[model samples]
Target: RSLAESLDAELLMYLAQRRITPGFLNEIDLFLRGHPELAEYTPDFVRRFNNARPLAAYRFFLKGYTRPARYVPGILPERDDQITLPHELPSVASTVDDELVDFFDGYEYRYDILRRIDDQVRALCNFLRSGGRLTWTQRLLVGLTLFGNPVDAYKHYEYNYQTEWLPHRYLPEHVVLSEVPKEPDYSVPTARVRTLDGADDKTRHTFLNTRRKMARANDAGV
Candidate 1:
C-alpha cells in the first residue's frame, strides 16, 4: 500500500502535466490498488516509490537489490542517462593511465533483455498508469534495465527464479519472429555459362566438321 501510494502520487503528477482527466486518474489509482502482487513487481512501483538511496541504492537497486535497507532511499538515474553495455571494445593504448571500458555494459547484455526491452518498457509505462511497487528483481528486469539484459543473461537466474518468488514470464512468440527477414534471396544472379576450349588441330577440325554437319542438317530440314 505504501509503495503503491507513492507510485500513484508520481503517476498522477505526470498525468496532470499531460492534462489527463481526473476520472481516468481515479480509475487508474483504483486499478493499481487492486493488484497488490503485480504492483510489487511493476517497474513504475520501484522507480517512483522505492527509489533506493545512494550507496544503498547502488547495492540494492543497481546491484540486484540484495542488501537490506537501513534508511530512506533516493532517486535512481533516468533511463536515457543510465549506463549501457559497451557496444565496442577499446583500442589498445600503451599509456599507464589509459582506462578500459568495464566488461559489463550497464545496458542489459543478455539475449532475453534484447528480446523484451520494448515490451517491458511498454508494460512499465502501463503499470505507471495505475502506480505500483516492483520487487528488486522486477525492478532490475523490467525498469530501464530491461534494455540492459534479457532473462537468460541474468547471473542470478536459477537463484532468483527459485527463491525470488514471483510470476515468471516466458519470452513471447513474436520476439523469436520479429528480427527475422521475410524476403526470398534475389540479390545474386543465377545464370549459367558454357565454355569451348581448343586444344589441337584435330580437335578443331572435328568441331568444324560437326558444325558443318549441323548446318547441312538445318538446311536440309528447312
Candidate 2:
C-alpha cells in the first residue's frame, strides 16, 4: 500500500482506540484535508476496530465524509436508557464504500454509547460533588458530560450522524470511561465506573455552583 493508504489505516486505528477532542480535531482536520478520501476506508477500519471502539463514536468522524453514514431517521427513543439502533442502514452505503461493513447488523454498538455517556456524567458529577473542578480532560469532554437528558441524546445523535462533526471527541474509551471495559464490554470497555451522587453539604454546594455555571455557559452558547 502507498504511504497515504498506510497512514490512513493507522489513523483510523488510533482513532478507534482513542477518543477525539475539538482542539485535537484541528490536528485531524489537517489530516482529513490532506487525505480527503480518508473517510472511504471506513469499512475496513470498522471491521478491525469494531471490538475496540463504540460505533456511534467512530461514526462521529466518518459522517458526511463517507457514504455509509447517511442521516439516521428518528431512531432516538422516548427514554435515555438505551439508544435504539435502526434494524438496518440506508442501502445507498454499499455503492459508496470501497468495501461493505456488515458488522453493524443490529444493537451491537448500543451498550457502549450509553456507557460512554454514563461515564462522562459520572466524571463530571464526581468532580462537582467532591468540591473538585473539571480537569483539563473533563473540560474538553464537556460535550459528552451532562447526561440523563433528552437533549444530550439529540446532540450526541447529530454529532455521530455525519462529517459535520464535533471536536469534543477522541479520548480513548478507557480514559473516558475511567477504567477499561472488560471483554465483550464496550469491546473497548472501561475500568471501574464511579459516580458522586452524595447528599453531603459540600457536594450539594459544588454541584449547584457548577450547574449554574454550566447553565450560564450554555446560555452564552458554548
Candidate 3:
C-alpha cells in the first residue's frame, strides 16, 4: 500500500508537469473505482484527487488550456495562409524515422507520450471537422501518428472545462462587488470639452484635474 501510494504520487507529479487534462484524471479515477482491490489500498484516493483538481490548476493556478473552445476559437482554416499543408506532416514513408514508426506500432502501451499527442489529436480533429479535404495518404499518416482508441480520442477531442476544478474566485458572480467599480458617467464637462492639439500647459493640467476628480467621485459613489 505504501509503495502504491508513493508510485501514485510520482505519477501525479509527472502528469502535472505534462499538463494532462482533467478528463484523463477522471478516467483514472473511474478505473480505480471499478477495481475494489486497488481502491482499498488508497484511502479516499478518488475523492482527494478530485478535490485537488490538478488538471484545472495545471502549471499556473489559471484554468487548464485543454478545452477545444480555448484553443480552437473558431473553425480553423483548411490550409495555411500560403494555401499549403504544414511542413510537419509526414510525406513519404521515409519521412518517418524508425523510432517514430516503432512508437506508433506500440502506441497503445505508451501512456508516457499521451501528453505529446494531445495537440496533434486536437489539430487533426479540427481539420477533419472543418470540412478540410485530406488525401488518403495524408489521412493514413495522421491516423498512424495519433493512433488511440475511440475513448482516448473522444476525451481529447471533446474535453470540457470542469467547473468544480476551477478556483472559487473564478466562478461567475463570485467577484466582490465593492472591489469592482460601477461604470462611470461619461458625461462630465471635461470629457465634453475638446482641447486643441497645441493647448497650453495650464489648460491641459486643468483638463486632467477635472477628469481625475470625476473619476474619484465616481469611485466614491459621490
Candidate 4:
C-alpha cells in the first residue's frame, strides 16, 4: 500500500512538472494496481532502501552499472531515454549469463518507466541526504521509488523471473532449481507402498523367528 501510494504521489508530481501526463499517471496507477509482477519485489525495495550503504548507495548506480542501462518510460515519450547498461552483456546461447547479458533486457525506457522512476527515487534519497538540490526532473524521479534504490530494486524482478519462471518454462523441469518440483513425470507414481498391510503365515513366522534369535543373542551377550 505504501509503495502504491508513493508511486501515485510521484505520478502526480511528474504530471505537475510536465514530465508526465495525467493519462500517463492513470496508466501507471493501473499498471501498479493490476500487475502482480512488480508487486512481488516491493517488500525488498522498502527493506533495502532503508539500510542501503551511504557510499555504496551513492555508487550503486555506478558500481552496479555493468553497462549502460536502457531506459523506457510509460508516461511521455519526451521523458523516454536510454542510458547504456552499466556493463557489457554476455552472449545468449544454450545458456544466458548475467555477467554478459543486460539482465533487464531493455525494458527500462518509459514516460514513467518502472526502472527509471525507481532510479529517480534512489537518487533523490541520496541527494537529500547529501543536501543536494533537485531539479524538477530529479524531484519527479525520486518519488517513483521514494524508499528504494533502482539497482537493488529492479534486480529482484530480474532474478525472480529468471530463476523462478524461465527454467520451468523455457527449459526442462530438471534444469530448474525450485523449492518444489515444477512439473512431475506422469509415468512415475506419485506415491509408493513400501510395506504390506497383510503378510502370509510364512513371512510372519520368519519375522518372529528372526526377532527371537536376536533376543536370545542379546541375552547371551553375543
Candidate 5:
C-alpha cells in the first residue's frame, strides 16, 4: 500500500507538470482524503489537505510551496548604460583571456541569473494561467534549454506513440483495435504458373496439355 501510494503521488506530479485542471486535482485530493491510510504516504496531500480552497491546495502541491530566495541587492550585477573600464580595455595579443572573459560574462551576466529568476517566478506563479508568469521570450529560452522547441518535442513524441500512453493491455479495447492494423489473409487463392522441365518434347507437351485440362476442369467445377 505504501508503495502504491508513493507511485500514485509520482504519477500525480507528472500530471501536474502537464498542467491538469483544478477539477482533476480536486478529485485526486478527495481520493487521497478518503483513503487515510494512503494519505500518510503522500506528504503533498497532507500539506495542502486543510486548505479551504481546492485550487490553492493544488497549486501548493504543484509548486511544492517553495519560497523564493530573498533578493540580494548587490548579488546580481546592476544592468546599466555605463560601461566599466575593464570592458573597455583593448584585447590582449593572446586574445584567449578576452574571449574567455566574454564567454564567462555572457553566461554569468545573462543566462545564469535569468535562469534562476525564471525558475523562482515559475515556482511562485505555478497556478498562473498559461501566459501569466513567463513572457514569450523567457518561455522560448527556457523551452530551448529543456526540450529544444515545441516542434521537435511534438515530432519526437509523435514518432514514438507508445510513450504517450500505458502498455497495450491497459488501453481500451476499441482504442487498441483502432491503432492496430488488421492482419492480411495469406491463405487466399492465387494464380500459379508451372514449368515442365527435364523431359523429352512429347512428355513436356503431354504434361502441359494435362495441366491445361485440369485447370479448365477445376474452373468449370467438373
Candidate 6:
C-alpha cells in the first residue's frame, strides 16, 4: 500500500490500541481532518477519542512532567548544536563554547537533559492546536515517539531512559494505557534500529512495555 494509506492505518491502530501520548491526540485529530476516511473505517476509535478529551486534567502538559513529543529528533537540537546559535556571534565562538558547558555532561540519564527542550515541544504542540499542518514525516515520527514502543525505540536499546519511557514515568496513569479491542490492520513492518550509534544515555536502567502496561527494572537490581 501507499505510505499515506499505511500511515492512516498505523495511526488508527495506534489510537485504537491506546498507545499514544496525550500530546499526540491533537495531531491524530488533524490526520483525521485531512483524511476523514480512516475515522469512517473505525468509527468507534474516533468516538472513543472524542469522548476522552474532556477527561484530560491538563490539555497541554507544559511543565512538571515532560511531554513525550520532546524525544522526536527533529523537534529539538542537541545541546552543543550551533544551529540554534545566534546568526551573528556576540562573543568569540570558542569563548562562548567554553563558558556554557554541558552541566549535565557525563550525567547518567542524558535523556533527563532532554526535558530542558520542553519549550520546543510546547511550541509545536501549540502550533498544531492552532491549526497548523505538519508534514506527514512529522506526524509519523511523532506517532512513533508517542505510541510505537513505549519503552525503547529499538529492541536492542533498552536502558538509560529512552524517550518512550518518559510518558510512563511522568504520567503513570495516562489515558493511553487502556486496552481496546483488536481491529482490521494492513500489516506495517516494525521499525528497525541497527546500532547504538549515537552518543546517548549514560545509565543502563531499562524498561519493558508489557503491552498496555509499563514495566521497569527493579530498584534492588536488574
Point to the candidate with the largest lDDT: 3
Instruction: Report clashes for each candidate as comma-separated counts.
Output: 13, 19, 0, 31, 0, 0
TM-score of each: 0.20, 0.25, 0.22, 0.19, 0.19, 0.22
Scanning candidate 1 in windows of ten residues, the lowest lDDT window is 91-100
Q: All models: lDDT? A: 0.34, 0.35, 0.37, 0.34, 0.34, 0.34
Clashes of 3: 0
Q: What is the per-residue lDDT of model 4 for residues 17-122, given as tens digits with 9 covering 90 to 100?
A: 4333344333433533553443344545424533554322222222333222222243211222311112322111222223223334454422233444344445
lDDT per residue (tens digit) for residues 1-222 in model 2? 122233345444544333322233344345445543333544444344334433343343443231112112222222332322233312221222211122233325333444454455455555555665554434323322321122233234334321223322322321212232334643422122234653334333345665664455445443
Task: Give me the displacement of residue 101 in model 5, in angstroms.
Answer: 31
Model 3 TM-score on a 0 to 1 scale = 0.22
Q: How many angstroms is residue 178 displaced in model 2 relative to the true structure, after the best TM-score fit?
A: 26
* Model 4 misplacement above 4 A: 2-14, 46-222
Q: What lDDT, from 0 to 1, does candidate 3 have? A: 0.37
Candidate 1 lDDT: 0.34
Q: By lDDT, is 3 or 6 better?
A: 3
RMSD of 5: 24.3
Judge candidate 5 at residue 174 and give its lDDT. Answer: 20
Q: Using alpha carbons, what is the TM-score of model 5?
A: 0.19
Give one digit per residue, the lDDT tens place, for model 3 in 1-222.
Answer: 121233355546645443343344454344334445423444354245445534322222122222121111122232333123444543222233322333245345434333334455446546866867665433432443343122223223223222222232122221112233334764433243445764534444456776775565455444
The Cα RMSD in angstroms, rounded to one decimal, for candidate 1 relative to the true structure is 25.3
The TM-score between candidate 1 and the true structure equals 0.20
Of the two candidates 3 and 5, the one with more favorable TM-score, higher being better, is: 3
